[model samples]
Target: MRDVSLLAGVSRMTVTRVFIRPDHVLPETRERVQRAVLELGYVPDRAAGSLATQRSGFVGLVLPTLSNGNFAAMVEGLTEALRTAGYELLIGYTSYSVAEEERQVHTVLSRRPEALVLAASAHSATMRRQVAQACIPVVEVAELPDDPIGHVIGFSNYAIGRAAGDFLAGLGHKRIAAIGASSDGERRDLRGEARLHGFTDALLAAKLPADMVRMEGDIPFSFTEGARIMARLLDEAAPPDAVFAVSDLAAVGVLMECRRRNIDVPHDMSLLGFGDFEIGQQMVPALSTIAVDFDDLGRRTGELVAELLQHDDPSGIARTDVGFTLIPRGTTRASVP
Candidate 1:
């Protein structure tokens, strides 16, 4: 800044304003400062500037994984929204562990983000307390927890599972099954478990057996795990006529494995999945999926964050439920015989 200001024949404060609030400077002066900045390759030290402004100019986002397309899309949308609001996004991945989630939350909080956002809301009590004490607005995305720690912009994972179950059950397929991640250990996907529970509830409510509902596997499960789990289901003496995977990643795996085994899908078995991934659309039998507008959810959450940061006083707690849709494609037939 000092070098650029000297070259531009302006004070250090003028250089600062050029980057922080270019609109405040005259067009000719701003153009000169920008040229100097470019020539010197000067980079603004945001950390130092943040001390003077007392605004970090960034929001924190925690996610289960970065590999998922839906998650990537959501983050892209979130970053776009935040960028338009003059903020950046700092992200951390927890790999589906509650402990890691707590650690990442603490790490991001220490950075003094204007707000915090979590992709999933299975927060530990300690984590929740820390977030509350951070004195910043918080948003829980992709889930509507029974007890939200802060503002929520998400749909119900349980409802998604129930909808999947109801749709499959309504197809006259008496023998139905589901596969999802088990939350028995600390490294868990609690949202997936909630979906499984909802699926179970739907099955029981319809007087259908929930025995075929297999709750086993781990996070980041796609083709290998999906195929592995599906193989187990196929070995059963009475294999299900239809199956639902908590994630489309797993559903794709199941579809590929079925193709390998020469089993006709929706003929010998029907399949459904969640997360409406692009890969599902390109699949041969184009997977049927429970779709959530995750990217839109991220954008909405970003807008909400910007809105929350505007007021000094804590505003009313807001909860937004972005619902899900069940998209039936070639993989799910209208009926099973």
Candidate 2:
């Protein structure tokens, strides 16, 4: 900064103002300072600036996994939004473990983030305490909580599942099966559970045969697990006419399994998935799914962060419901049998 200041024939404070508050500096001086900075290849030290301003200029984002396309898109959207506001995103993954998520929260918070975004609504007691004590604005994504510790930006997980059930049921499929991620006490599938609950509740409400809805799967939501559980279901005396998979990964797995066994999809069995993964859309039978606009969720989350930081008012916006959509594709059809 000193070297750039000297080259620009300006004081160190003027150089600082140019980088931190360019709008306050004269346009010609700003241009001169920028040229000096570029010539000297001088980079402003964020750590030093943070100490003086008491702002880290960073927003933390904690998500489950990078492998999930929906999460990736969310990250992209959030990054773009924050970049527009002169903030960077610090990202960490918890792998869906409550303890790990708690650890990640502490780790990210240690960097002194201005705000934080979490994908999971469920948290360990320690995690909750950490978030409360951090004193930073928090935004929970994925599902809106009944009692939010901070702000929330998401849709109803249960409602999406219920929509799935209604869509399948409306197609005249009496025998419907749901494949879900089995919860490990430590890494519970809260969203999956809610979705399954909604799906089952909708089925019951529709007067669908009690025996027609079969719940299965103790594995995580993955393509391999989808295949494994689907193969198991196929061995049963009476195979389901349609299956609702907790995720597109698992749904595609089921579709692959059907191909392996030469079981006709939709003709013999229909398939539906959640999350609307990209690959699902290009499959031989495009997957029907419960679609959450994750990119939009991320954008809204970033907007909330910007809003809180600029106003220093966490309560300015309490909740944002991005909502979800049920997309029916080729994989799901009106029951022909």
Candidate 3:
């Protein structure tokens, strides 16, 4: 800052004001300081500045995986929302592990973010304690938990699962099945598991056998695994006429596998998936699946955070349920009259 002031022919206070309160500084002076900063490649350290202001001006966001486009969209919306409030996002991915999430929380907290937002509500005991001790606002997004640590802004994953099951069943498909990750290791997708349970209950309610719901796959399920799982599903003695994938990526994989095996979709078999991903919409036969407004969810979460931070006394524990929608495209069949 001292060197920037020297280069801009201004006092250190003028340089500081240019970065902190540019509106208070003259336009020409602001331009000079900005030019000096650019030439020196200088970036202000919010963490250091927070020592005086007590405002870190950044929020920590924890995500499960970057591989999913839906998560990416959420992050994009969140960043944009935060930008207007003069806050930035410090992002981290946990690869669907509670332990990793705890580690990430610790690392992010070290930087002293004003708030923390988690994509998943489930956390390790240590992580919960740590977050509580930090005394910062916490926001849980993507999945609404029964007991949230702080504010909740997301749809019910279980309801999405149930909706998928009900959609397929309503189409007159009696033999139904679902594919998602098995809770085999410490790494898990709790949201996917919730969907599976919801789907199971929905099937049982309709008096359809829920035994075919196969929860066996890896975390962050992919297109390749979807195809492989679909192949195995077809080899069963009593194959299900309809299948629900935990992800749209997997559904596309299933469609590809069906084509390879000369199976006609919505005729010989019907497919459904969660997440209304772009590729699913662009497929030869558009995918049928559950859709959540993840981008909107992120934007809302960010807005909530900004609102909380701006006020000295925030309102009560807020809960916003954006809900889910079931979209039936070419991949799913409706019962004939």
Tens digit of lDDT per residue, candidate 1, span 219-334?
76677788999999888899888999999999999998899889999788899999999899999889999998888988998899888887777668988998988999999998
Residue 324 displacement in candidate 2 (angstroms): 1.2
Error of 3 at 59 (Å): 0.9
The model with the greater TM-score, 2 or 3, is 2
Clashes of each: 0, 0, 0
Better of 2 and 3 by lDDT: 3
Question: Model 1 off-target regions past 4 Å?
Answer: 26-28
Error of 3 at 58 (Å): 1.6
Model 2, 1-337: lDDT tens per residue?
A: 7799899999999999987888899999999999999999998899999899888889999987777899999999999999999899999988778888989999999999999999866788898898899998889998888878788889898898899888888888887888788766677677888888888998899988545443455535889888988888888898788999889999999999999999888788899999988899999889988898888889988988898888754445578788888888889876555
How well does each candidate superpose onto the true structure, as a TM-score? 0.95, 0.95, 0.94
Supply candidate 1's per-residue lDDT for 289.
97
In candidate 1, how many clashes are counted? 0
Model 1 residue 231 distance off true place after TM-score fit, in angstroms: 0.9
lDDT of 1 at 234: 88
Candidate 3: regions farther than 4 A off: 6-10, 23-29, 45-47
